[model samples]
Target: MPVRQLADAVERVAPRDRRVWEGRLPVAGAGGIAVKVSPVRARQLWMVVGMWDRAVRSERLRGRRIRSAAALFGRSVLEVFWDLAQAGELRALEPGPGRERALPTATLRIVRDCLGIMAGLVKPADGAVRLPSVEQPEPKATVRAEVLGEVYRGLVDLAGAGPLERDGTALSYEDRTRLLAMVCVVLDAAPRSGELAALRLGDLTAGERAVGLRRRQQKAPPNRAEEIAALAEVRPSSVRAVLWGRRHQVSEAVYQRIAAARAELEPLPEVEWYALRPGTQVALRRWLAVRERLVEPIQGGRSALWVTLVPTKAGPPGVTLRPQGLTQAFARGMTALNWVMAGQYGWEPMPTRMEQLRRAITVSPVPAEVVGK
Candidate 1:
């Protein structure tokens, strides 16, 4: 159903932003530019609004955020409500897999951003509900670099052992090689899950010494109106208000300031070429060989660097593995790694999340020699 239709009867009759239905809601972004959200973000926005609408109709939403959403949008209490209690619980309310697990902080942040956008679409009301802040969990403590080094050593040994023993936890020979390469890449380059998933066979250099990574821009730019409002403290309030109302009227100085700040804050480039460690290059080469064999059966060929090990509902063994699949496989690989180091002394269980591993690597970088070993 169209998001506009999800609104109350009075709201439905009001002049609607057609892009709301198209799922390409234009948000004022940095420098007063009308920033269009990526499709993924648009879908997420639709999902949150849908969820909020359902919660309102069921009277399950009661809290300051919903009240604020209503007041901010100049809508009635019945017309706009979000289940802040449910969201605050840090679990998915929907009855499905992963409903019990606490939602990722990133997911919660996105939900908050989406709700704010929805509120911005409407005229301001008399009252206000400050958009609630997401509850942040304590940062996961990173393990020592020596710990990751030892784990990497174990993984390398496992890969060099030729074929893994057949068991429920055992991965296929092809998958084993692929997992090793993935681990090596993560430890060496620390690509995000999305960036890793988006990798293609062509991303590899001629000699496979490095991988060219293209960052997917799934996130929309920061709200332009909000930034302008903030700048009102430094700039003329009247001019800031004018810029807020007319995004295109934003000054180049404002654009340069925002751009500079963002560049400093987000140091990661949109595209980066990371040189692979010797061990990483070797593992990648091995995976490439195994991957070639796997895709040989397919008529046209596959471009994805990572392919499924076995037939799935999506396709045969050679089909591109989705990001979720890659993550699950990485977890299984971690289990296999634990199995390899079952009785080893001076070793701890490796962190399962890629983020944790990245942090550990950043804190104490394992020497290239340790990685190659």
Candidate 2:
């Protein structure tokens, strides 16, 4: 059963899911918007189970919708599923409890998520698109000022966040250190789980380098890492920024950059056409879903720094978390602050945990020789 689940996870996320459903959104002409459209697997199963938007195309995936999922890159539906379920695409013939049951809810959810993930996997200047009606429009650059502002505000707020305030500030020194250790662990866990970015609260100690920062997210497999790390050979400017960052200082800078980028974004046709909202907004709490308030120290008296990584949705289990040591004292120093908590944590899926760590721990490589230079 364990191996079965692992195999399912792999098959579900295999290249078949990444490839466009050529059977559905077949190529038309050059200069198309989305060179290809996403296909549904058990995807329609989601809509079959629960609520969904009225705008989706249910006709596209129907009887004989899928073939197989083998050699999927160039292979067709004939490979994967013996009878590819049209669960990703379905239309209700009747209200409820009818002989005509649509796709399952889980399938529909999978389709949507897969589409989103593969959307970015497209090749640049992939091709042009032709719609049912209306002439093709010119490709234009989007200026997303609002998007930028939203990202900026969210990061700054997170950075400026206060302690859990469980009992009171006078958190015994032992408690502070324990919290710091948890923070490091949490940061390492975020991105792999599938959220966004994450960081540790810090100031590089004198001549300390090689510290790493990483975060994890939820949508990914536990073993796949989605974290970011500080470049080993970073410029002096970046090192200074880390060394001097205050509570949420790095967040503010990150926000400033995102805000600048958002200003240049605009809702693309299909990208926003069937979207839930013209422009999606990410909640900060969604970013820090894993959290716990422990008045007592989990570790008796070990010398390891931890950051609080709170996974979204199910959060991390208290008993299963473990922290790794970094040779750089600066990262260790930042771990002592307890102000920063990376968005990573969860021992059930160990890979997701490391994915988060990879993001929260940044590896700043100062040539070891550059130090004297």
Candidate 3:
């Protein structure tokens, strides 16, 4: 039946519920006329209206101090229903003469949400009502361990090599810089991706003892401080030191020569840096060098630590790297590392690089001087 005729039928039989279905048709016919709604659509609409009416009446019957149950239902249950519909889980039943259709996914979701909402609203003495939700299955422990191991190995490689050449293609100066900065930040501060993305050049204050990171926490309290020790054993040609050394210059001939030389040399075996060690300092220095050269530091306005080197016709020179972009970059680096590792050594079911590193660290004895102290 046409929507107008259905509206009329609903008005005659359930005038109070007419407004519930008003202007809610998903589609309209030609000339902006109300289209004929499926029998399933009509049924679902009426069922919701009926449910709403019952909820309202129940609130009055209970004489609760709070607002009407219908109001609560609209706020919670109705919203959940719309969410399910938008997710494409709600579909109209097939038009048939006499066929019992299974309950739609939307209907089930609505019912589930409504029951949970109503359970809280209704008195416990009313009945033995229980709301059961299936827990989502977690990823396998081995799989999770493997992923973390890959990420750990990738980070170590990045720290050592500064953005590596993948498939005979070297990353742009800007990309290499960004990856270097990300790895250094992660190693030194262990900040969330958002926090890392939020960092600015000004936020990094170099004191006599350490390089301090002063940034507002995205998920926690404001004004957290993280430090990279000044005396920390970093590579002399560290990314941090390089960045600091060539802060003003657009291009550094020395750094480029060094980078080129490193690229030509045999790749170093990936090594883990413990605490405030040489590896961390080297990564930090290298990252700083690249960031200084590539990123145009604009004070106050879009002064993000990581910015885009290339600008489009629509935008400015320094575009801040968003958290999402940072995450994608990290994932890409991990994938590249994994691919390289796979090529070098076939899947032979050996302990992860991380596990091996841990074993090595465990077996190594402390220095006599440090132990005595």
Q: lDDT (CA) for every model shown? A: 0.62, 0.28, 0.43
Give the per-residue lDDT digits (tens) of candidate 3, residues 148-210.
344445556644554557666555545654665565445444555655666665544342112
Q: Which ten residues in a row have the lowest lDDT in candidate 1?
A: 6-15
Highest-TM-score candidate = 1
lDDT of 2 at 184: 34
Cα misplacement distance, residue 356 of candidate 1 (Å): 1.2
Provide TM-scores for the models.
Answer: 0.69, 0.23, 0.39
**Cα deviation of 297, candidate 3, in Å:** 8.0
TM-score of 2: 0.23
Using lDDT, rank the candidates from best to worst: 1, 3, 2
Using lDDT as the measure, name the better of candidate 2 and candidate 3.
3
Between candidates 1 and 2, name the one with more favorable TM-score.
Answer: 1
The superposed Cα distance between candidate 2 and the true structure at residue 267, in angstroms, equals 38
* TM-score of candidate 1 to 2 decimals: 0.69
Model 1 regions lying over 4 Å from their true place: 1-35, 60-107, 123-129, 162-167, 216-269, 299-301, 363-373
lDDT for model 2 comes to 0.28
Better of 1 and 3 by lDDT: 1
Query: Per-residue lDDT for 201-229 in model 1, tens only?
Result: 88777677777777443332234334533
